[model samples]
Target: MILLIDSGNSRLKVGWLTATEDAATQTTANGQTAGPLMRREPAAVAFDNLNPHALGDWLGTLPQTPRLALGVNVAGPERAQGIHDALARHGCPVRWITSREQLLYLKNRYTEPTQLGADRLVALLGVRSRLPSAHPPYVLASFGTATTIDTVGPDDSFIGGLILPGPVLMRSSLARGTAHLPLANGQVTEFPTDTHQAIASGIAAAQAGAVLRQWLAACRYYGQAATLFVAGGSWPEVEQEMQRLLKQTGGSPNTHPTAYYLDRPVLDGLALIAAQPDPLSF
Candidate 1:
C-alpha cells in the first residue's frame, strides 16, 4: 500500500492506495472520479485531535504496512516530524513531497517557492497534469478552513492566489461580530424563513461570492475559458448554493461545463505525481 496524507489546518486527512482490483472503485466512491476525472480516494481515512500516536495507532491497524508514504502538510515540519516518527514505528518509510525547480509543471511564483504549502502545491500539480491546455487557464478553489483561490496560466505557470475565511469561518465570524446573528450551527434548512436563514444566506453568499468573483476575473484576464474545481470540507454541504451562485453571477462561460469535487484530491494528486517514473533513474 502507498500511504498519502493531507494535514490541513483543522484536520489530518490520511489515505492509502492499495494495489488491489477494488482500488479504482473505492477511489470513485471517495468523492473522487477515477480515470479521466483527475482524482482518487484514499484507501482509508481518519480525523482526530491531531495526535500522532492516535494517527499512528490507526495506521498500524491497516492490513499491511505501507511501503511509501507521500503527503502534503500545512501544519509545518514540527507536526510532520511527529507523523514521520509514528510511521517509522510501523516500519513505513515516509517522504514529504517537495516543490523542486523542475520536478513538475508548477512554476512557483511565491516569494519563497519552497515555502508554499504542500496541499496547495499538490492541488496545483494535479490540476496541471489533468488539464494541460495551452489556451485556457485553470482555476483551483479549495474551500476548507479558509477558501483559497489559485490559478495556473495556460503556459502552466503558478501565479499567486487569494485566500479568505471559509464557510464555517464566515458563519462563526458573523455570529461573533454581530449582535443579532446567533451562532449558526451545522444544520441545513430551507432558505431564509427567519433571522437564522437570513444569517445563513448572508454567510453563504459571502463564501460563494468570493469564489465567483475570483473565477470570473481569471476568465476575463486569461482571455480563454477556465476550469474551476471546488474541493473542501464545506463544498458538499454548500454545493447547490455554490452552483446557484455561479449561475446567478454569470461566470459559467469561464467556468468549466462541470465542476468536480474529489474525495482526497490533494492525496490523489500526490499519488499521481509519485506514480511518474523517476527520470533520474531512467
Candidate 2:
C-alpha cells in the first residue's frame, strides 16, 4: 500500500492505494477509464487539519504500515518538516511530489514549470488521466486556502490558470480588513438585501463568475465542449451559484460548460503517479 497525501495550505487529505502487479486490469472507482497502468483509488479518504494528533491517529489506524508515503505540500517548508517528522515517527518513509517540467505525456507551460504548485499539477493529472476521450477540454477550479482556475487542453497541455482568495478567505478578509463586515453567515440569493446575504452572495458570484469566465475561455481556446470541474473545500459554497450563473448564459446544452464535482483530486492524481514509473524527477 502506498499512502497518498494532499497537503493544502491549512488542511490535509489522505488516502491509501493498494497496487498490484496486475495494474493493467484495474479501473478507478469513479469509473473513469485510463491507461493500463491506471488502478482503483480508495473509495473514501480522510480529511484533516494541520494538527499532529489527527495525522498520528490516522496512521495508527492503518491496517498496515505503508512502505512509502507520498505527498505534495503547498503549506511551505516548516509544515513540511513537521509532517516529515510526524510520518517519520511512524516508520513510513516520506517522498514529496513537486512540479516537473514534464510528466505523464503532459507539457507544463508555466514560465517556470517548477514554480507551479504540485497540488495543481497533480490534480490536473488526475483529471487528464481519467477523462474520457469523448469529453472535450476542461477547466479545473480548486477551492482551498486559495482557489485556482486552470485550463487544460484536450491534447494534454497545461495552458495557463488564475488564482484568487478562497471563499472563507474572502469573508475573513472582509472582517479583518474592514470595520463592519462581521464574518458573514448568509445564503447566496439573487438580490441580497442584508449585509450578511450581500457578502455571501458576492463571494459566490466572484467564485462562480471566475469559474464561468475560465470555462468560457477554455471553450474559446479549444472551440469544443468544455467541462467545469470544481474541487476542494469551498466548492459546495459556490456549486449552486455556479450552476445558476451558467444557466443565465448557457442557452443550449452545448453552449455552456457542464459541471462535475471531483472528490480529493490531488490524491487521485497521486494514486496514478504512484502506479506509473517514477519520473526522472518530481
Candidate 3:
C-alpha cells in the first residue's frame, strides 16, 4: 500500500491506496478515467493539541503496513517532523513532496516555483488527472485557514492566483484588529441587520467574490467558460454563497460555467503523485 499525506495548516489528511489501483482507470465528473484511486477512506486529524503517540497508535490500527509513504507538508518543519516520527514509529518512512518547476504534464508558472505551496500544486495536478484532455481552463478555490484561488490553464500550467484570509480567520482578525467586533456568529444574509450577521455575511461575500473574480478571469483568459473546483475544510460553510455568486455573475445567458466540490483534492493529488515512478525526485 502507498500512504498519501496532505498536512495542511489546520489539519492532516491521510489516505492509503494500492500501487496497482493507483494506475487503474476510473471515470470522473468530466468523464475521464485517469485520476487517482483510493483503496480506503481518508482520515483527518486536527493540528491543535496533536499528540504524536496517539497518532501513532491510530496508525498502528490500519489494516496493513504501507510500503511507501508520500506527504506534502504546509504545516511547517516541526509538525512535519512530528508526522515523520509518527509514521516512522509505524515502520513507514516518509518522502515529503515539495513544489517543482514541472511535474508530469503540469508546468509551474510562478516566478519562484519552489515558493509555491506544494498542496496547491498537488491540487492542480489532481484536477488535471481527473479532467478530460480537452477540459477548459479552471480555477481551484481552497477555503482552509487561508483561502486560495489558483488558476490552471487548459494546457496544464499553474498560473498565478490569489490568497486571502478564510472565514474563521477573517472573523478572528476583525475581533482582534478592532475594539468591538465580537467574532461573528450567525448565518449569512443578503442584507444583514445585526452586527454578527453582518460580519458573517461579509465574510461569505468576500470568499464568494474572490472565487467569482477568478472564475471570470479564467474564462476571459481562455475565451470560454471555465470550471471552478472548490475544496478545503471550510467549503461547506461558504458553498451556498459561492454557488449563488456563480449564478449571479455568469454573464451571458448561455455561458454558465461548471463548478464541482472535490473532496480532499490535495490528498487526491498526493496519491497520483505517489504513483509516479520517482515522485520524490521532483
Best lDDT among the predictions, by candidate number:
2
lDDT (tens digit, per residue) of candidate 1 on 190-269: 46677767767766767667777777777788876667777777776567667666655554565334455545567656
Write the residue-wise lDDT of candidate 3 on 1-282 in tens digits: 777777888877777655334233444334344333333323232232344566678778878887777878888998888888988898988988788899678899999999999889988887777776777788889999999999998888988999899888999999999998898788888999999999988899999888898888888888987877878778877876776776666567555554576767776677667666876665
Q: Which stretches of candidate 2 lie over 4 Å from their true place?
A: 20-44, 133-135, 253-256, 279-281
Q: Candidate 1, TM-score vs. the true structure?
A: 0.79
Model 3 residue 208 CA deviation (Å) reads: 0.4
Model 1 gets an lDDT of: 0.68
Lowest-lDDT window of 10 residues in candidate 3?
40-49
Of candidates 3 and 2, the better by lDDT: 2
Clashing pairs in 2: none
Clashes of 2: 0
How does each model score on TM-score? 0.79, 0.87, 0.87
lDDT per residue (tens digit) for residues 119-234 in model 2: 99999888776566545677889889899999888788889999999999999999999987889989899999999999999999999999888988988889875767778888
Rank by TM-score, highest first: 2, 3, 1
List the lowest-lDDT window of 10 residues for candidate 1: 21-30
The TM-score of predicted model 3 comes to 0.87
